[model samples]
Structures are given as C-alpha cells and as structure tokens.
Target: MQNFFPAQYSTLSAAALKDYLIKVYQLDPSTTCRLLIRNVSDTYILENQTQKYIFKIYRDAHRKCDEIEAELELLNILKAEGNSVSYPITDVAGKQIQQFNAIEGIRNGVLFSFAEGKVILDLDSAHLTQLGRDIAKLHQTTSSLKLNNPRPVFSFETTLFEPLKDLKPHFSEMIEEYEYLSNIADKVVKKFEEFDTSKFNYGYCHYDFFPKNFHFDEAGKITFFDFDFAGQGYLINDLMSFLNHYFFHQLNNLISREQAEKDFNTFINAYQQVRPLTDDELKAIPYLGITFHIFFLKFFYDNYDDWSNAFLTPRYTKHRVTLIKKWEEMYCNF
Candidate 1:
C-alpha cells in the first residue's frame, strides 16, 4: 500500500522532497532512506557517508505563521540556558526557516538534527525526576527570550462553550453525541474562573508535552521535540497536561491517584528547585487539571466525526466523559 500524508498536505511530492534535500544539503537523492508522514507534517531522512539529517515539510503554512522560527529561537534560548534540545538545520539562505509556494498553497519547511534516544512513557522515577528538572531549566531560561508568536486562539471556555452556544439549534444532536459534556464543561470553567490565573505564571511552554514529544537517552537524560503548539500559557497548565497524557490517558494502567499525585509533586518539586512557585500557583494546580480535562473533552466532542482527523483515538470520547465524572466526584468531596 502507498503511504502519503492526507489530501490536505499531499502537495509534498516525492520529486519535490528529493529536490529539496539535494539542494539544501547537497546529498544524493539515491541515499534517501525513507520518508514518513506525521499528522500535519512530512519528514524525510537522508544518509551520506558519515552523517544523516531529518527534513520536516510543514503543511498549512497559511495558518502556521513563522512557527519554525519561533521553535528555533526557543531552542537556541534553551540551549544557552543549559537545557538539552534538538537544533534546527539552516537553509541555503543561512536561515533556520524557509518559505516555499506549492500548488496546494504556501508551504513552510525546516530541518533539524535528529533528536537522540527513545521516548519512554513508562519511565522510572529517576527519569521522571530528570524530566521535571529539565523542564524547570527550560521554563526558567525561556522566561527572558521574547518570542514572536501569540498563543493559540482557542482554549477551554472559548473552544467548548462558544461552539456549544453557536450549535444550540442542534442541541439534541450535540447532546446525543457528547452526553452532557457541555454542562460538565461549564462547571469546569466555573471552577477555574473562581481561581486566580495571575497566581499561575505564564510563559513559553511545550503545550503538547507527551512522551512522544520527548527523548530519553541511555544516561537517563531527556530532550524535547515538537514545539508546534509551544507558546505562552500558565506553567502548571502544561505540566498537568503532560501528566494527563502520560500517567492518565496513554498508560491506562492501574495508576493510583496517590501515585499520580506523587509523580506530579516530583516534577513540580524539580521545577521549583530552579524557579519557585507562589501560593496561588499551588492553589491553581487542581483546578487547572480539571480545566485542561474539559478543554480536551470539548476538543474531542467537536471533532467527533472522522476520528482520524484528530491525534486522539475513538475511545478518547469515553475517556473524556470518565475524566469529567472523576472531576465531579473529586470536586464534590472537596
């Protein structure tokens, strides 16, 4: 079977990918080992006598802005601050980011030195602790690098309720599929609103900090990748989102709430070693967890049809409902 990116980004032709590689790095196209499609991006690998490089072709440039620039800038900032990260490869123009026009639309692209090691989800305490320390270092240093992009336009309240309000005419249909997610989302939003966002510090964060976006070397060191969704946000927001993805959703093992809480504290403690958190930030953690849960719930609900369009699986709908119920049970007890 032939493998290619979805129709939306099929503009990346094989010949074009080959040409881009040869022109950029002077590598022989015959040495092209493989090309793979990742969600909205296409990646190609080329091998010469002694070196290899990964070229990433980005789709949807119209909406992407100069995100590669932001990512490279962020990486440089983190590296200067002593955080390990993948470095972006420069183009013939001596720039990290390059713009190209394809038949489908304008496509922006960049290359990167391949990040090392494997992404381990079921990591041990030592690795998790290292992840925490590394992330803390990143957050601490990135606070000063003024970035060029804005936060993504959507969030828990705006992405969920705003759409529900507009879709009121089809309340029955929406409710049928989501099963009271809107009402639960409202409660989640209310709980978050009651808390002070000011208490939680905001800065550039790897919004999608899943294990897949991380690397664990043999020495137990961690390096992060995919700053596609990176931007300014509450610090704990990304931390909890990482927890939800690794400990909660992805593993689905018998992770006791107590154990999960311990892991969260470990990461937070390591982060605080370099930069301390305020009383308000501590208070905001629990509510922010609930808010992020509802945020993804609405995300799943809106894209209910054609599950492949999303990074989540079809079971994500059920997982979201369960998370909401868990939050409700915990909230009432509190």
Candidate 2:
C-alpha cells in the first residue's frame, strides 16, 4: 500500500458532497450539487425540483471552527429577528456545521437556505430605500447582542495598526506605497481622536455591504448574504461600505457625482427613518473608509498563497495605494 500525499488545499468532490448531504440532511435524492465559486472558500449550489440550498466549505486558514460558529449564531439571530438573510440549515442531527477530513485537513461546511433573488447593481431609488431600511432593521439586532463564540473585531488596532505591521514584509519592494499607507493611517488615527467617539454607534457590522453581496427579487425584496467579514465595529462601517459602491460608480463614470450623492442621501434618509445616527458618526465614515482599504490590502497579502499570486503584484499594490490617495483627496479634510 502507498501513502497519500499531503496537500495545502483540496477541492471536495461535488458528487460525494451530494451523496453525503442527501444522507445527512435528508435532501432529495434527485438534488444536484455543483460548485458555484472557489475562492477563500468553496460555494456549492444544491437544488431539487422544489427547493435550493447553498453549501459553503470554509478554508481553515480563512475561518476556523469558532469563527464559523459565531457567524452561524449571528445569522440565526438575524433570521429570528425577521431579517431577510440567508441562514444556516441544520441536518437530521440538528447540527448546522458538517465536518470533513480531506487531503489537506479538517474542513467545516454549512448548508444555507438559498436567497431567492438576483443581484441588482444599478439600484433605483426604491431599491436604495428598501436596502437602507432593511439594513437598519438588521442593525437593530446586531448592535444589541454579543456572541459566545469568538470572531474578529474591527478597530484601530485590528484594521489599521496590525495590518500595517503584518504587511510590511509584502510592501518591502514598494517603500513609497508603504509609507503612504502608514502616513494616512496615522492621519486617520489622529482624526478619530478629534471625534467624540462615545456617541458612535457600535455593533457587529456587515463590513462588506456592497450591492453584490445582496439580492433583489422581482417584488424588490432585498436579501443580504456573505457574512464572511462581519465583525464588531462601528455600525456605520456597514454604511461606509455601501458608500464605497457610489464612490467607485463615480470613479468609473457609471454615475455622476451629483447623482451618486443624491442616491446616497436617499439611502441615508431611509436609514435614519429607522435608526438615528449621530453627526460625529456620519463625519467619521470617510476616515473609516481609509482603514477599510488598508485592511483589505493586508488581507490580499496574507492570503496570496491560497488566493491569486498574480493578483497582488507590485503594480496592483501601487494601484491600491493610489486609490487610497484619491479617496483621501476626495473625502478627507485632514
């Protein structure tokens, strides 16, 4: 007998997953399972004649067991509060997480109720308003509670400082870009010191609220998914991420800056109708936006081995830094 060779990452077979799920979750035997996406994690779509489901297998490097449990707990809470989120589904054993030992190591998977809609990129006024209200309603639950399982926390330390330190090795070749990030991060910290953060609303933010993470049915109902980046931070972090959609839209000339502002205002107004935001919190969004960019830059660097090596080249790194500079010029006062 020969020994099996070790692997860093392995793709699980869809046919095998279909069989396992059918047996464990009591899914229809006729259901088909196909890989939907293979990124930081692997997403599979399983469906039969009557129902559809999403099974996500998380990379241990990206998300560990505790973090996955926390995410499931958050989704469970959101679903119970009547939020339109794709939530975890339990198997016949009443377990939401399924364990598998693959060639690499142990991988955790979860079956989620399929969100019934498609993504709407060019959102109209009605879509914007509904999205705002739904997000506010979701925040109502996320802001109030704490999870027993641990998840990442977004803060000056985690998002700004730690990322900068961890990314130094990756940025060794691009000293100017690294300096720009460090200087801007310092400015962001100084700017935050100026604000009376005691009034800032704190909670678990969706952290990645771009239009692509959500879907809208023909009836215009919005369902948000992909909580992979959800964490404790300023609740306004969610709002800032939504604003990023408009920022990119204006940059790419998809929408005029005037209209982007008007559209964002519509979303803000609807959000305020449901939940009140302080003036200081609104003022801090752009600065928080800086941290968002730097955090993700480090993320790309850290996950380059598992993700794309060619995607995070010196040119890409410089481009990201340039975008951060442009963001500062457009929005920041300091």
Candidate 3:
C-alpha cells in the first residue's frame, strides 16, 4: 500500500478564526464560535446576535474540493425545491466553499445555516414515518439534478468485495473468519450480478442517513443535515443503510428491536407512498443491506486490531454469518 495523507481534524481556535469570519462572512467582530465536536471533522457553532450558523473545517486531504462542492450543490437543489434542508451559504465573494491555511495544515471550510430544532435521539413510530417520508422527498427532488463533479459510487464490489481483498494482509488472529467473510461477500456479488441497477433507480443520495444525522421540530417537520456522505448511488442503498444500522443498534440493545419487523414495514411503506420502489429493488434490499456488515467488518479489522474485544469473538463471527443469513431470509420474505 502507498502512503497517503492522514486526517488532521483538530479543533478550530477562536483566536485564529476571527479574521476570516470578519473579513469574508461580514460577521460582527464580537461573534463567538464554539467548538462542538472534533470527531472526523472540526465542527463549530457560530452565533452573532440572533443569527446562528455552522462552520466546518474539513479534514485535510480527506475530501476533494469538487466533491464537497457537489454535495453543496445537492443542498441548494433540495432547498430550491422547498425540501426544508439546511443549505450552504456563500461568502461576500460568492464562494460557496473555501479552503484556507489553518494551524494544522491547509483545509477546506464551508458555512451552513444551522439546522434548527433539538435532535431527538429516541424515535417513535410517528418520527420514523415522517423520517421515511422526508428521505423519499429528497430522492424525488434530486433525481434529475446534475453535478459537474460527484462523489464515489458504492456497490457490493466497492463496499464489500474489494475491501476484503485489500485487508487480507492485515488479518492477524481472525484470518479464518476473514476468509469466511470473503466467501460470503463473493456469494453476495455472484447472486446479485444478474440484476440491472441503472434503470432510473440510481441517483445522488445521502449515503449516511443514520438516526443522529437528522432533526425534528415541534410542528412535526423533519430537517436533515450533514451531506458529507452524499453521493450518486442506488436509491435503495440509502434506505438499506438506514435499516441496517437501525438493526445493529437493536442487536446491541441500544433500542427496541421488538418492533423491528413492524417498524421496518412502516418505514418502507411510507417511502413507497412518495416514490414507489420497484419489486426488484425490494427484493434486493436484504442483499444490499448486507454490504454494511461486510464493510464494517473490514473497517473494524483493519483500522483497529481490537476488533476481537470490541465485536464478536472468532466463534461468534461464524455465528454472525448464520444470524445474517437467517435475517436476510426473514427480510426477503417480509
């Protein structure tokens, strides 16, 4: 493997950021920026008088400018269609995204209108239904939107098939389990190779629609933010990612999976009411959802040698394979 730039996602210091915000964004000199979270990217909350905004400094060398701009374009399209998204705002020079020299290194920066309302961590049926409807609306809105530069596309091969191969050399204690995952990934590829995925079902989608990425208001409106993972891919991919992660949370007792089947139906039916998912896409959901487990398995194994302590034991890895097969069967029959 070749060497590449590692993430330099240190927090933004208030002193170093004042000049840029004042000169470019025309904010008051007394504006205060608070570091919200330094994970993956440095995110800050900027407040001056009654105005509130989000300032994000992208991790150096992690994402390209054009790709970030494409995501920004997606926000504009959704907002123009009255979809209630927190869109990106431009500075005085009409620049939607800016790159500046930071104390760590050169990094990309963009400002956004703060998505209002408090985040609801524990979701009920009503919230889930509205969430489903909201995502379907986004899929419908950006179906035909064009972008000069787009992010990478994902597939069984990209998400699962190739990652296993690349991580083969990294396996230490779980080499056998890694081999089993490789075979499972291969079977997934061969089984689903016959379908045509490009039949108007592919478009730009929020690749990460996990629970915490959206917020709800008292008036029962849903506003989704965080388009860092937005890209062109199968529309169903978004739905599957949501469902798979929801199930993962359930598996760990983070939430109630007792209503898993019923809730799953509600979300899918709500989505279909807005934008009908074809029979083929419906059949493919289980297979597509398996991609997440495969991707994360490789991620946990490669990045952290502590996967054994954190996740299933080697014996349970095979157990997980069995559990996944049974779950897929139930999902396909659902």
Candidate 4:
C-alpha cells in the first residue's frame, strides 16, 4: 500500500489554490471554503468560488484513477437524462478528471457539481417508498444508457471474503461463527450461480445504495451520490443491499419477523411497480437478502481487531446474532 497523503491539511496554499482554479476551472480567488467529511481514501471536499464546484482529491494515486473518472462519466450521462445524479465539472478545457502531482505520490482529482439535497437516514414509510421509486428510476436510467464498466464484483467474495482472508488466523477464536458464515456465503454464491444470471439481462447499477449515500430534499424528492461502486450486476443485488440495511441493520430493535416481511415486501413491491422484477429475481430475493445480512454482520464482526478505535457497540453485535437466528428460522425452516 502507498503512504497516505495527509488530507487533514490542504497541501495547496490559498493563493496556489486560486491560481489552480483559474487554470483548471476558471474561478475567482476569494471563494469561501469549508470542510465536509473525509472518506477512506482521504478525498477532500473543497468548495470552489461559485459554490457550485466540489473537488474530490484522491490522496492515493494507484487506486484506479481511470475507474473513478469512468464513474464520473457515468454520472454525467445519468444526470444529462434528468436522473438526479451528481455530475462532475470539467477542467478549463472541459475534462472531467484532472491528473496532478503531489508529494505523497502522483494522484488524480475531479470536480463535481454540488448536489442540492441532504443525506437522509431517518425516513417514514412514505419516504422509504419514495427511496424505492428513486432507486428504481436510477436503475432504469442506467439500463437505458447501457454503459458497461468491468469492475470487481461487490459480493461476499470481493468486499468481505477477500479483505478478511489474511485475518482468518485471527478468526480462530470465533471459528464457529466464521466457518458458519463462510459456508453460508458459499451456499449463496452456488445457489445464485445455479441459474444463468445473464438470462436476467444484467445491467449497470449503483451496487451500494445505502441511505448515507443518498439524498432527499424538502419536497420528498431523492437523489444519489457515490457511484464509486457503480458497475455491472444483477439488479436484485442492489435491492438486497438496500433492503438488508433497512430490514435488519438500521432498526433499533430485533425487527419482528412480521415487520421484517412487511418492510421487505413493501420495498420490493414499490420497486417492482416502477421497474418490474423477473421471476428468477423474485426467487433469488429471499436468499440474497439473508445472505447480505450475514455477509455484513460477519464483515463488521470480523473487524473487531480494530474495535479499539471503532465506535461499534455491543448492541450491534447482538443484533447480528439476532438477525442470523431469525434468518435461519425464516428461510431454513429451523
């Protein structure tokens, strides 16, 4: 891994930044700027002079600059169709991604048109239903574009299993739980693979559609950001990520089986109303949803070694156990 550039401090001086803006984006020097949140790769959010352009600086150069550029291009395509996506701003010559030299290493950056809405986590049933509709619209829009980007798969294999492979020895203490989830992940892949996924006509999708990455305005309209994980996949896989978070993870209590079924069906039905699901997709839902729950539970649980700095609570762990048992009883006929 390359050394991380310090994102906490702005490497560009105020004067230097102003000059760069003029060269890259043709902006004024007296722009007011404020810091937003920092991401894993140390991307910094710098509001340009007009308050319209938000620059995303990738502190790490080797981590697929081309992929990020492609993601921005996809967003631009979706936004042009009036799909409510965050669009990237271009250089002075109107290029989306700008390659620059930095001390930590060679890195890339891109500017985006600031999205207007706020990140909404707390929502009522109506709002949840709206989210379903918006996501369906997003998937539909991407499908129409037919843009293909061959990125890494975001299933249990890539996101969870691969990252945790080295930590398997550390998982010996929790061998029972680890092995159980490992087997479950394998079963899910096998079951889903049993059918021809291509038969369902895989399309481009925002693979990670969690609430934090979404925005909703005062008028009940929703928009999305963070297309970093956007790629080709079965549409239901995206649905599973959203439903798993809502039904199992987000709620405060052990979600009652009845409520779980209700919430799941509500979301699925609302989505299908806008963009219908195929028969194979409907059959795969129960397993895929449960698999998502288990995958994230173990994924979070396996990160306990870093728990010292982590704010993860005991309640979170208990909820995973609860979810696992409930999924087993509901799906496996326990």
Q: Point out where model 1 deviates above 4 Å.
A: 1-7, 14-16, 27-33, 151-172, 176-179, 246-251, 293-319, 327-334
lDDT of each: 0.65, 0.93, 0.74, 0.63
| Model 1 pairs whose backbones collide | none
The all-Cα superposition gives candidate 1 an RMSD in Å to the true structure of 4.7
Order the numbered candidates by lDDT, best leading. Answer: 2, 3, 1, 4
Candidate 3 displacement at residue 23 in angstroms: 3.2
Lowest-scoring 10 consecutive residues by lDDT in candidate 1?
303-312
Candidate 1, 111-187: lDDT as tens digits:
77777788886666787778888887788776656776554533564546665564454344445545566665566
TM per candidate comes to 0.79, 0.98, 0.84, 0.75
CA RMSD of all predictions: 4.7, 1.0, 4.9, 5.0
The best candidate by TM-score is: 2
Candidate 3 ranges beyond 4 A from true positions = 1-10, 194-200, 254-258, 296-334
Model 3 worst lDDT run, 10 consecutive residues: 303-312
In lDDT terms, how accurate is model 1?
A: 0.65
Residue-wise C-alpha lDDT for candidate 4, range 1-334, written one tens digit per residue? 8776544323433345445765677665555443354443333455544575566666442247657756876887888777887788767686887766665446576766666778765456787788778778877777765544445455656644664474366456667655766676667777877556666646676766787777787887777777766776677778867765555543456566566667767777888889988787877765766555654554455444323344235555445656765665555421
The local distance difference test score of model 2 is 0.93
Per residue, candidate 2 scores C-alpha lDDT tens digits across 62-148 of: 999999999999999999999999999999999999999999899999999998899988988999999999999999999899999
Which segments of model 2 are wrong by more than 4 Å? none
Better of 2 and 4 by TM-score: 2
